[model samples]
Target: MPNRCQRLLAAILLFAAPVHAETLLCHVTYGGETQDLEARPVSSPYTVPVQPIGSYFLFRIVFQKEPADLAAIKLYVFADRDSGPLPIQQATHPYPPLAGKGAGFGFTGLNQVYEPIRDGELQYWCEWSPSSGPAR
Candidate 1:
């Protein structure tokens, strides 16, 4: 009887374990140089930071996991401006992306973003996967 109870408790605990977290990874390129950007689930999109890409563009990514049914990932691109950053483009994808492992969904091909004023070209692609550990 004691062994049966122990097994039942273990089964309950196993089912209650949280799902593994997911990660969004992107490779951004500008002016002959490339850099990697990573984002994890966050409660608030406002907490994410805008990253600079080369001299003319700023990039931002947001991953939301709460309200589980509406989980989503968003990507934003901005053109650097003297007064502030100007929004250029935005992309959103439903969580657990339609693609299977090793295949990521994003702006179809080599996504090219242009800064209206400087005419600078920035390219980027992104993928999502179950978090294995610390980001690279």
Candidate 2:
């Protein structure tokens, strides 16, 4: 009986594990699916200090693991009041590596560019909206 249960458990563990990608953009999964993600404190987990000069957004994206996986995550800072469901940011990046044995990994910097709205408060959005996820 115990042997049967062990075999079942091993099968479940092997089949259930997600198929991690080959390339290492981030050392862990960002959310789960939806490939893209917003540059927020929660979703991003890591962050960097801002110099505060040109129009830019500074954020650090990290996944703790054996090796630090890093890449450029796209971000768009918008006028908060700018409406149409939600404020938006376009992300263009290669998918990161999966977390090895420890945590995940990623990168951070001020996205320098002004994709502006005329008049509104400052708000932002990316594909990976962690808001929908359970709080950590």
Candidate 3:
């Protein structure tokens, strides 16, 4: 009997373990092409390297992780360059019945461009957006 109970407990534990989000999908438009980038988690202010495209000094975008729902993630942005229009964007997800499952939901940033990398530092800043949501 004890053996059977242990087996059941093990099964329950296995299923109860949290399945962390595997990748944070960030979409951006570059040269009219929808580019898909996988975001890596970082400490402090959110930061992600992006491919350079245009003359725009500031970029704003949305990034998301799946298995998530109605909620959004809020954060501030900081870079080696000047990023203005502070007090970064706020939560926009408005589903009253569900909490998001993944990270990077409704995340917005006023990223600074680091174009033309110097001394091994990042030279491009990518701002993810909602239109760039997880899809092909």
Candidate models: Cα lDDT each: 0.79, 0.32, 0.37
Candidate 1 residue spans exceeding 4 A from truth: 1-20, 100-109, 133-136
**Lowest summed lDDT window (length 10), candidate 3:** 119-128
Candidate 1 accuracy as lDDT: 0.79
* 12-108 per-residue lDDT for model 3 (tens digits): 9999986553334444443445444555333322353333334332232234343255233332222224453333223342212133333433232
Q: For candidate 1, write residues 22-122 as lDDT tens digits.
A: 77778899999998887888998888999999878999998898878768888899988888988999977777665632334343235789878777789
Ranking by TM-score: 1, 3, 2
For residue 132, what is the lDDT in candidate 3? 27
Candidate 2 residue-wise lDDT at 86:
31
Every model: Cα RMSD to truth: 6.3, 13.4, 10.8
Better of 1 and 2 by lDDT: 1
Off by over 4 Å in 3: 1-21, 46-53, 57-136
Report how far off residue 91 is in candidate 2 (Å): 8.0
lDDT of 2 at 25: 25
Model 2 lowest lDDT segment of ten:
22-31
Better of 1 and 3 by TM-score: 1
**Count of backbone collisions in candidate 1:** 0
CA lDDT, candidate 3, residue 68: 55
Question: Can you give the TM-score per candidate against the true fold?
Answer: 0.74, 0.25, 0.29
**Off by more than 4 A, model 2:** 1-3, 16-73, 82-106, 110-136
